[model samples]
Target: MAETSLEQIRSRVDADWNRIVELLKSKIALRSVSAEGITGDHMKRSAQFVADELRKVGVDAKVVQSANPDGTPGAWEVIGSRIVAPGAPTVLLYAHHDVQPVPDPTAWNTDPFVGTEIDGRLYGRGSADDGGGIAIHSGALAALGDELNVNVKVFIEGEEEMGSPSFIPFIEAHRDEFKSDVIIVADSGNWSADIPSLTTSLRGNTCVDVHVKVLDHPVHSGQYGGPILDANTIAAMLISSLYDANGDLAVPGIESQEPVGGLQRDLDESTVRADAGVIDSYTLAGTGSLAARMWTKPSLTVIGFDAHPVEGSFNVISPETTFRLSLRTAPGQRPEQAQEALAGFLESHAPFGAQVRVDRLENGMGWAMDPNAVATKDALEAMREAFGIEPINKGEGGSIPFIPELQRLFPDAQVLVTGPEDPKANAHSPNESISLSGLRHNVETEALLLAKLGR
Candidate 1:
């Protein structure tokens, strides 16, 4: 095998830029949001589209069916393979095809399902989250073509946004097809537009619904204001107690670990404010370095509250209220332990002797990767060459549950968590976008990585 020039790889990706964008736009138009009770033709279509695109680049591809416990078809997973060099290490490229629902269409600058390019960015609900990821894989493989020296396996999942309910089963059913020595999980984020990053760790996650009841029914506030306690008030108080004045999670039994150390590029207050859409006057919560709090500590968020809307407010005390609590457990903490600790804390501290019920929703463990692995070293060098800057070693605050599962399945394999998402790419939200230039650079980086690992 000969040394592949970086210029040749860049030129190949640049030549196929239009085809890549067109492929992404076709996927974005599918509306394959895998929400609960939502299964349909679009999901299969999206998965098939991925397979067909890979086939166009001289790869063998197909859409595999995701199944239920009873062996019923649920969703689809696309798998593609290109074996250029026999006996070479197989690299599995992973991403997802399904996206999140557009909760509010009015908040978007363009149709959430229509991929739009503006100001050197591509905007759509899944544009950056994973549609860009799919393009990156396809473009990288296309760039290498027959010159690729490794056996490549591409796995695109279908239910990532819905927490991958059938992911483990799907993988278990097809374990042989997923065999690989290295996996590049292309569903994470970059530090910024120009700054590449290798995600070093991810936080565990759990959710529980807290229900409180203070009375049998609503009562007139005017007549019982002084004597009665409203369910909404008590629920709000209990939720508030989960965090201290400094914004730290006040729950006990959860554990924390040392943050991943390497790049000192701490997300500043201004960047946080802008990226999170926080008001200027509001102060950031928690303690320690922002990186530490984000990646190494437990954090709780109120996802939703089941209470009466302010629009139809009357002078009455509500009987019951329920709130959904989303907790991000620290890297070392167990989800079951965190769930128990949170539920117990809420039950023991019930305000004014109110009846409390906590229902656990979901749980996922965190993951950490060795920084000195051969594939990791190759990826870092490839990224530096592609982006012309040292890639930052960072950890994501969000959870990618299947990453740990991959590690457990192949303990000796190296897992590289890398993606093209930046701060402005509002994935899982309206008006999501990805930098076009950034996507090109990331594709080239992946191509170089595959070349190096093949050697």
Candidate 2:
């Protein structure tokens, strides 16, 4: 694609790998967890760190905060760019500096904030999910420096962990600034540490809060327990109905799409079980190949719920109980449609005449990639050279809602979803990590893709 051969790019990545890891390690040390009711300047710190790093690569980088829907201050974001040539195609490199909250440090074998090196991997919160994404872009830019043929832009958002609440407003307000011909979303993981993949499809995600009421106030269990079921009992019944006996989503009007080209990307059952830490006695649910059940099919999860703590024994029946449902939509369905279908199901399936009310929490859109797109072909070739093997197309059951929104905003832009994460990265959980070699490969891949596209 250019005078800089794959061997030369590999040499550059290897030479600078240590410094890139240090950059990501510093980022992981910054607790940039994006969630509501959180009070701290860590988000700003994360944004500033990304901006400062971008400037080192000759980008006019800055920390930006978008206005909320009510005109209030919103989440932090990092924006930067470098114009190589006037006629060169503009490429937007995407990543998020924010990371998911680590609810329990006790679950980790090492410090969640320290990027620890162990067995050829770097372990810490934000190390893989999007922190690795940031490193990929930074490393690519550093590797290519002045010879980068494409006009490059980098946008690192802060609230991805909060479902990107201000993403639309943030982008809409700066339409021209973010406009590009190709968008590289380095937020997804490869198929495996040894196998590279081009993410072809992703499920959109939506959530609903369900409130169930059976009585006016807490009643004595001795007096009311015999006559009627408690609100918690009723809530359990409603939650139970969310899935069929086989465990597929039982909500109405929701549908699944066959993988593009109708060829399935199946996962090994043993590996799936291992990855999930599934108990040996627990039976796997649903139907079809493991990959379809994961990537193409809808799944329902009870993410949040509130009853009473078991430690405190109370002989009273709860008057009401509230629970939250998280639904991952199939690729073809929109977040709104899935939310509506789920809300309708919960409202209609109340048990024993219990009053049920459903409220929308949040949602994000999903996307499918065009396999034949010129950019996709270029990316595959780049990945093949970097990984030294033919890359495979894979779909993630996890949702990256901002991606579909980007497609909607820039209809003419060709989007490429590539990243440094591997299957065992354990993003959003304790002991999250990124593969060292894989990270270097991704940096090489991005540099190569941009080099090829510009040519």
Per-candidate count of clashing residue pairs (backbone under 3 Å): 0, 0
TM-score of 2: 0.95
Scored by TM-score, the top model is 1
User: What value of lDDT does candidate 1 attain over all alpha carbons?
Assistant: 0.87
lDDT of 1 by residue, 197-286 (tens): 889889999999999999998899999987787898999888888888998888778776667654367767778788888987887888
Count of backbone collisions within predicted model 2: 0
lDDT of 2 at 344: 91
TM-score for candidate 1, residues paired by index: 0.96
Candidate 1: C-alpha RMSD to true structure equals: 1.7
> Which pairs clash (backbone N, Cα, C closer than 3 Å) in model 2?
none
Estimate TM-scores for all models.
0.96, 0.95
- Model 2 weakest 10-residue run by lDDT: 34-43
In angstroms, how far off is 328's CA in candidate 1?
0.8
On the 0 to 100 scale, the lDDT of residue 417 in model 1 is 94
